[model samples]
Target: MTVLILGLLLFLGAHSVRIVADGWRSRTLARLGEGGWKGAYSVVSLVGFALIIWGFGLARQQPVLVWSPPTAMRHLNALFTLLAFILVAAAYVPRNQIKARLHHPMVLGVKLWAFGHLLATGTLADMVLFGAFLLWAVLDFRAARLRDRAQGTVYPPGTASGTVAAVVVGAVAWAVFALWLHAAWIGVAPLGRTF
Candidate 1:
């Protein structure tokens, strides 16, 4: 649990810099060139990610139940996760309406993913992991939107082809993850597959 908490702090702390200390972040970026800043950020993020994986694994070894979620919640999480994947794809795909409208689909995806997982899983570690992410995503999304508004940022209008492409990519990725990777990597099959 301590390791999990530490990991969450490090990960979320790194992510929260822009939200909480944009001025500082900007100054740092200026002091260090874009390349240097990115290099440092990537290193911190990676270390945090490693800690999160290790901590979550350790916490899961001694399962501390919080509240038992109904089976329906798990099914609902599948739908939410599917949408999350679509949003994730939107964030990447050029000129997708989802991204154009949302302006921060990736953050929204994180929010949805965290919320869905929180609903589906009821354990101390699960709450710590998903809850923290959910909170961070909400704040980050809000901060990003505010920044966009302040800067008069405009997303390109989306074409039908781009939208279709995003949907396909998201659906295919979701299917693959749900069918195989979730079970293999997360140690729990979201789709409840026996294999």
Candidate 2:
């Protein structure tokens, strides 16, 4: 639990610099130069991510039950996760309506993913892990929106073809992950069957 908390602090804290201290981040970036800043950031992120994986695995071994969620929550999580995948896809798919409207589809996707997992899982580890991410995403998204507004950011209008492509790519990726990769990687099959 301590390790998990530490990992979350390191990981989420690193991620929160832009949200909480944009000026400081800009100053540091200027001081360090792009390559140096990126190298340091990548090293910290990697270490933090590795620690999260290890600590999560350890915490799962000694399960601490919190509240038993209704079975329906799993189905809801599935739906949420599916949408999350689409939103994430929108972040990268050029001229997608989702991105054009949302302006920060990736952050929204993270928010959905964290919230969905929190709804479905019942354990201290789950709460800490998902809750941290949920809080972070909320703050990050708000900060990003504020920044965009301040910067006078303008998103391009989405094309029908690009929107369709994003949806198709997202759905296929979600299906592949939910059907096979979820069970293989996470050791839990949300849809009850795995390939």
Candidate 3:
């Protein structure tokens, strides 16, 4: 629990910098140059991510029940996760309608992903991890949108081809993760067995 809390703090704190202190982040980027700033950011993000993985694994070993979610919620979670994957794909596949509408598709994806996980799991560790991410995503998404508005940023129009590509890629990625990676890495099969 201690380790998990520490890891969450470090990870979330690093991520929250842009949302909380945009001016400071900009100043540091200017002072350090893009490459230097990227290097530092990568290092911190990696360390924090590693810690989060370790802590989450440890915390899961001693599961603390919070609330038992309904079986129907599992299906809902799957649907939400599917949507999330599409949104995430939109973030990379340029000129998609999803991305055009939601300037920050990645943040929206994070919000959906976190919400889906929260619905599926009901343990202290689950709540802590997913809830924190959900909260952060909401705040970060709002902040990012606000910044974009202030700058009068306009996202490019979407193309039908790009939208189709995004959907296909997102579906494939979601299938791969759900069928193989989730069970292999996380020790829990989201689709195979109901919890």
Candidate 4:
């Protein structure tokens, strides 16, 4: 638990610099240069991520039950995760309506993912891991929107073709992950069957 909390602090702390200290981030970036800043950031992120995986795995072994969620919550989480995949896809698919409307589909996707996981799972470890991410996403999204407003950012209108592509790509990726990768990687199959 301590390790997990530490990992979350390090990971989320590194991620929150832009949200909490944009001016400092800009100044550091200028001083370090793009490559230097990115290299340092990547090292910290990777170490934090590795610690999260290790600590979470360790915490899961102890299995501290907080609450027993209804089975329906798992089903609801499936829907949320599916939509999360689509929103994440929209982040990359050029001219997609989801991105045009949302402006920050990736952060929104993270928010959905964390919230859905929180709904489905009820353990201290789950709460810490997903809750930290949920809080971070909320703050990051708000900060990004505020920055965009200050910068007068304008998103391009989405094309039908691009929108379709995002949906298709997202759905296929979600299916593949939910059907196979979830069970293989996470040791839990949300859909009950794994191919």
Error of 2 at 79 (Å): 0.2
Candidate 2 residue lDDT tens string, 1-195: 888888888888899999999999999999999998999888888888888888999999999999999999999999999999999999999998989999999899999999999999999999999999999999999999999999999999999999999999989999999999999988999999987
Candidate 3: list runs displaced more than 4 Å: 193-195
* Candidate 3 structure quality by residue, lDDT tens digits, 1-195: 777777788888889998999999999999999999988988877787888899899999999999999988888888888889998999999899989988888889899999999998999999999998999999999999999989999999999999999999999998888888888889888887533
Clashing pairs in 4: none
> lDDT for each of the candidates?
0.93, 0.93, 0.89, 0.94
Tens-digit lDDT string for candidate 1 (101-186): 88999999999999999999999999999999999999999999999989999889998999999999999999999999988898
Ordered from best to worst lDDT, the candidate numbers read 4, 2, 1, 3
The CA lDDT at 94 in model 4 is 100
RMSD, every candidate, angstroms: 0.9, 0.8, 1.8, 0.7
Model 4 TM-score, 2 decimals? 0.98
Name the best candidate (by lDDT): 4
Off by over 4 Å in 2: none
For model 3 the local lDDT of residue 182 reads 87
Query: If the candidates were sorted by their TM-score against the true structure, best first, what order would they fall in?
Result: 4, 2, 1, 3
Off by over 4 Å in 1: none
